[model samples]
Target: MRHIGKLLLLTSLLTSSLAFGQITADPEERGERGAQDPLRSRTPEGNPLPFMQRLRFGGGISGLSIGNPFSIGVSPVVAYQASERAVLGVGVNYVYTRLKLYDSAGQRYNFTANQYGGRVFGMYEIVPKIIPNLYAHGELESISVQDNYSGAGLPVNRTWIASPLVGVTYSQRIGRLAGINLSALYNLNYTTSSTQVYGSPWVLRISFF
Candidate 1:
């Protein structure tokens, strides 16, 4: 009788284990018991589309340097992305320069110049996040010079020149709509008729736009 009772208890325990396994193995019950996953419900390959894939604009100004016949100008720029790694931009600048000429016995004269330009450029990002950007541009400038001396009777002259630019710019991305950029450019061609100033026409550019 005791052996028979033991057999009956083993049979009951086996039946209970089988019932528990069946309940746990149900697809709906297993799903309910599974842990929540935040990233699992995303689109198939896990890359949703960006709000704007390829459009940007920026602009800024530089400090003034009128002495040494050197001056500063403000430049405003706008761009459109042609591809993932290339961008095309256009810019405008308004500039002024002044020279103070003084002779023996404190005789003094002031000369002023006004210039403006429009530029179109292209940028290629080879190493988008690691180094400075490589760029090239062309500019058309309208220049005028006048003497401010009361009796000098200096002629006011105006002319236009085309300047080619090649440079590298370092950019720090601040956010979706902001960045800091610093650059240096060598002006390719400044004809003798453009300006009779002594300094090289290279421009050092800086901006936050």
Candidate 2:
């Protein structure tokens, strides 16, 4: 009878020990399993912001021109992604130039030069993440020259240059939705040199979009 009582007590103790062991080990084992899982969240840190909430803005502040004389330029831009791969924006540009030369006498003369413009641009990515990334680009630009440069020889104070450009763009994404843009484009309006905005038909631009 004493042996039977001892066996009963031992079994009860063993059951209680097993229950306690499970209660203690279950949490640690679950934690380890959670650590192994890639999508499990063990800590309080949350994910990044949503893509729509990620609005980006960028512009150019300085530029240098290399030609007959030394010139400098600056352009500013603002844009928002209209779709998954389309962006629409506007920008403003300003350029300044200076030249010092003398003709007959040894005197010094300073000349003023400038080219200012505003841009309305759109970019749609056709083939993304590949070689020769194709983008459909379009812009309507209004440029203004200084009053001194505007005479019978040149047009007027302001000139509008419109073009539908298609080209290859290379971009590097820094975070979720923000990135830098570098594009080499050809102007489709290759009618005459008088209608062109920049010097050449092929234009290269760097921006943050």
Candidate 3:
């Protein structure tokens, strides 16, 4: 919940800053609703594209599954354009994990857990290169897992995990408005809870807007 609050506040600040910049009249750029704005969009004499006209929608997937203990998990994100080079998004994370054990006599013991969580994230392009655009990224995630036990009268065990990361992404543009990215991030909250079925703090993304 604390992480949720932090994410909301960060998102609000980012949007508010962009909004303020857009609404404030700039000496060089056309106003948002000004007729000159469209004039600037003309091919030969155009300024950069309008902000709203550049809005993009896209998503990406990340995760892995293992065979031995029968563990599987996935993390997916849905993103929206926040500015010319910035994006904000949400994600759903889910995983199924199991463990098996046997006693000396021949009895078997098995345990399982179902884990699920939510994530909020932001990405901003810091250097606009032709290929392998560089962007800064950050995200907050929360997840929970409850253990499954076979015995009656056993207390249910549940654990919650929070992951926070900040990193950089290198991407090659697919076109004017799309790209494929490979990212390397360092986890700010690197606890046992922040660990993942796949490598933690590193990610790959495909997006368009």
Over 10-124, each residue of candidate 2 has an lDDT whose tens digit, in order, gives 4344323221000011345347555321211121233332443434556543224355334444455666555446667787765555545675888766555566778787777
RMSD of 2: 25.8
RMSD of 1: 28.0
Ranking by lDDT: 3, 2, 1
Off by over 4 Å in 1: 1-53, 62-66, 129-152, 191-199
Query: lDDT (CA) for every model shown?
Result: 0.48, 0.50, 0.52
The superposed Cα distance between candidate 1 and the true structure at residue 32, in angstroms, equals 35
Of the pair 1 and 3, which is ahead by TM-score?
Answer: 1
TM-scores for every candidate against the unseen true structure: 0.61, 0.54, 0.54
Residues 1-209, model 3: lDDT tens digits:
34334433543443332211111223344444342322211232334545654433343334333443444444444555555467677877665555566789988776555578888888887965333257798888777755443342377676777767678876564434445556666666665443333334443433322
Which candidate comes out best when scored by lDDT?
3
Ranking by TM-score: 1, 3, 2
Q: Number of clashing residue pairs in every model?
A: 1, 0, 1
User: Relative to the unseen true structure, what is the C-alpha lDDT of residue 118 in candidate 1, on a scale of 0 to 100?
Assistant: 74
lDDT score of model 1?
0.48
